[model samples]
Target: MAIFDDEPRKKARPHEIGQDLSLLSVDELS
Candidate 1:
């Protein structure tokens, strides 16, 4: 959740879908 919250502050455009993508990427990395 922290990743999703922090991502929007930096990306700030496609938060709708981008948050999911970011979560996936973090999951894969983890």
Candidate 2:
């Protein structure tokens, strides 16, 4: 699926750390 492919792209980039942090905070808060 497209979703599965997109996940690895995000994980592959170090620059994605900022995006990951934002998502992680929201996940933790909820």
Candidate 3:
């Protein structure tokens, strides 16, 4: 219950994790 309450209550869709990383260059990360 706590996990669901804290989280968005939805499973992560495919290809969702790295989308933001793709937008960033190496310099921005460092």
Which one wins on TM-score? Answer: 2
lDDT of 1 by residue, 1-30 (tens): 999867764565455346687765665455
Off by over 4 Å in 2: 15-30
Q: Which lDDT values do the candidates have, in the order given?
A: 0.61, 0.61, 0.41
| Candidate 1, residue 7: lDDT | 76
Per-residue CA lDDT of model 2 for 1-30, tens digit only, reads 889776765564445456697765554454
TM-score of 3: 0.24
Query: After TM-score superposition, what is the CA distance of residue 19 in candidate 1 from its true location, in Å?
Result: 6.8
| Collision count for each candidate, in order | 0, 0, 0
lDDT of 3 by residue, 1-30 (tens): 879643542333223345555534442343
Q: Each prediction's TM-score against the native?
A: 0.36, 0.38, 0.24
Please give the lDDT score for candidate 2: 0.61
Candidate 1's displacement at residue 7, Å, is 28
